[model samples]
Target: MYSEEQKMYFSKNLLDWYQTHKRDLPWRRSKNPYYIWISEVMLQQTRVDTVIPYFHRFIDQFPTVEALATAPEENVLKAWEGLGYYSRARNLQSAVREVHERYDGVVPASKEDISALKGVGPYTSGAILSIAYNKPEPAVDGNVMRVLSRYFLIEEDIMKPSTRTIMEKLARELILDGTASDFNQALMELGAMVCTPRSPHCLTCPVMAHCSAREAGMEEALPIKKKAKPPRPELRAVALIEGTGEHAGKWLIRQRPQEGLLARMWELPHVEWATTAWQSDEDNQEALRAALAEQEQIGIQPEDWFMDTEHIFSHIVWKMKVYRAKLGDANRPSTGEEWIPFHYRWVGPEDLQNYAFPNVFVRIMREWQEGNEA
Candidate 1:
């Protein structure tokens, strides 16, 4: 813990450093609560460089809370297509709609009120209240945690609730008497630029002299962390089925179920690897044919289909073998399964921009496009 005078001095020195060295980010240029709220939510677990374009495009499309509230969920989801964590986008829309109806399209000014919104937690509420409304509240995120831990030489595991309690207490105690917003931003900026998670640049830190961790030669080890969980493995097989005749130019794309991972997103039909027995290519094809016949009651021959390719996720490795099959002369698929018409939408050489696909899908599309180009 710091003496009141030491806290004030540290806050002043950090703010001075920030005034001279802070990056001129787009979000920093405005005090509007809506814009600040949007930027804060988007920056969660996402880098500034990645969020910039998304921020601009999103703001342009929905300039105000009212605009966001009025926009269709599909259009909002489309705009947020490439960005992962689809739940954030959904929560954002829900919050905006609530604000429009309940708050008269005005974001709440108090921390309690702001925190009441869907997905808006203590940190987000503090950020909006202090940064946008100049309220005297501290926004204690990981960055703030690092700075506080180093300055106080705290040794608690940052993942633990007790550590968060201690950090928040210290943060509230250290906030400058009337400069809480600037003080919080300075701490965040200092952590991001100088008191980094890795080798901290203590020599350049404005409050290095006041940092107990630096003084004790434990700057790198002050903020203890919890061990991470092991990643789970999964496998999937995707089918790139094609249509014939007028629909010949299209391919089948189905919307994912509204629950579970990647909910409501469009994807090619797929089967879990565990659900099917692993077999040779010929055997696999026969198995797939039989499954389709039993499941969709499709009477299609397997010889007309050709293998496409595969993809993988963070925890899952997919050994997908895609099969391209041309439909018969019949307008209706012989299979009882719904044959949603998708044009071969040939994402030709440079024509892939017409499709808005997820990053994983985009990677696969690129590979297929490159093959076509070659």
Candidate 2:
């Protein structure tokens, strides 16, 4: 248990350190609740450096809550393309739409109202409230957890919900009067810049003199977290269907179903392999053909194997094998045209920007483009 004096010391020193050393991130330049909200959402499961450009581009495109609310879902998804976790984009738009409709284009300042917004979890709500509105809310994210664990020498398993609740209480107590915004940012900044997950720079830490973990030489092991289970692997066969005739310059892509995994994002046509037991390339090719024909009613003539790529999500790993193929003549009618499905489209290289794609599909498109240039 930290004494009130000790807590004050930690809070004071951390804010002083942050004032001098905080990074000049673009999001920090404004007190606009909307920008702060977007930055917080992007920072989840993503790094600061990576979110910078995305932040700039996103804000530029949808400068106001109303713009984001009115923008096409595809455009929003396109803006968030490389930033994985498609649900964040969807939920953000949903929340933005709600803010537009319910809040009159204003970001709610109170915890009660902000928390009710879809996808605005406790941490994010806290971040927006404190950073934008200067509310004394605790933003107890992973960085804050790491800093708190080391400073207080707390050994709680951070994965547990109970531990987070405790941390939140402790965090709230540590906020100096009228410094909630800087104090919370300082806590996370210390964890990010000095009290890192491994071999932390205890010597450079602002709260090092009072850090229980540093004094006890347990800084490296203080924040005890259990390992997560490995992603389950699924074998997927993807068809890189090229176009011919009037659609000669384009490649085929389809929009995902409006619900479930990577919902509404553009991706190559693919089917999961029922079994990874193909005896030969011929068997694989034939299986790919049959699956597409039966499932999508789109016929393809598999020319040759293209490449194999792997994408890992939190729970699933897709081990995909891509096949180079052209629209099979069987799918062309005697009317001398290809029967294009409503959901599928022939997109050329220049047309790639109009749709949002998961990173895996983006990689495939980049690879194809490279081959074209070569």
Candidate 3:
């Protein structure tokens, strides 16, 4: 536990600094709980600079809770195209639908109601309640934890749930009367701007004089974090299936299954390999042809290697090798013994924007487009 004088100094100095130095972000312009909710979700594991445009576009497209709740899932996914971790977008829509139906389109101020919504965790719930409703709840996130750890010299591993609970309790106690909104934001601001993960700007930090980590020369090492396991690698073979005749200047794509990873998102036809041992171009193409025939009942004749790329997720990294290919027998159903799957589609350059694609597929398509134009 920290002394009252130390807590008071930190609270007063941080609030004073924040009033004059806070960034003029778009979300800060209003206390609308919906805007606060959207910004908090967008800010998770994403930088402010990267989220600004997406936030603006998202708000313009779905200006109100009712508007977002009523929008189609496809349109919502399209709007959230580039922002990965699409589960956030999906959960947001599901929760907003609840708010529309149950709460009369108003974001719930009570912790129990908001926290029960999909993807509305403690940090997000606290943010919505305090920033939008001016409640005295603490919005403790990684930023706040880092700031607290260094200032108070708490040496617990931040990755642990217990440490987070302690940080939350301390954060709540720091909120002075009528200052919860600014105080929480100020803590987050200090962490982002001064008490950074690497070399902290101690001299510029308002609470530096009382920072226990700075006093002990451990500012960079106070908030310990356990390293996460590396993403497992998976080798995959992708087919850039080109179209001919009536379907000229187009490529084949398909939507993923209704469940699992990247659910319902469009992607180029591809198959995963069990091992990392990469094969020769000809062998890889043969494997792709055979795999496509076996998996989707589609026949293909690979022309040549197109490119190699990879897409990383939190748990897996897909190392993809793409090959240019054409339909083995477009006019007949005998080649692979069946019709094209219902989820497949042939899309030209202009049609690419009509479907929502994972960023890796988008990258591949862009590269193909650029090479063709050249």
Number of the top TM-score candidate: 2
The digit string of per-residue lDDT tens for model 1 on 1-374 reads: 46777677788899899999998888889989999999988988788789999999999999999999998876787788677777888899999999999999999997777788999988889988888887888789999998888888888899998888888888877776677777778888898889998998989889888788888989988788886564454445454555554544345555566787766766655566555446666656666666655644443334433444544344545566655444433325567444433422322324334444555665554554455559
Estimated TM-score for each candidate: 0.85, 0.98, 0.97
lDDT of 3 by residue, 236-287 (tens): 9999988887778888999999988888989999999966788899999999
User: Model 2: residues >4 Å from true position, as ranges?
Assistant: 276-279
Q: Tens-digit lDDT track for model 2 on 35-83?
A: 9999999999999999999999999999999999999999999999888
Model 1 scores a TM of 0.85
lDDT of 3: 0.91
Q: Is candidate 1 or candidate 2 better by TM-score?
A: 2
Is candidate 2 or 3 superior in TM-score? 2
The global C-alpha lDDT for each of the candidates, from Candidate 1 onward, is: 0.73, 0.90, 0.91
In terms of lDDT, the best-performing candidate is 3
Q: Which ten residues in a row have the lowest lDDT in candidate 2?
A: 274-283
Local lDDT at 263 for model 1: 69
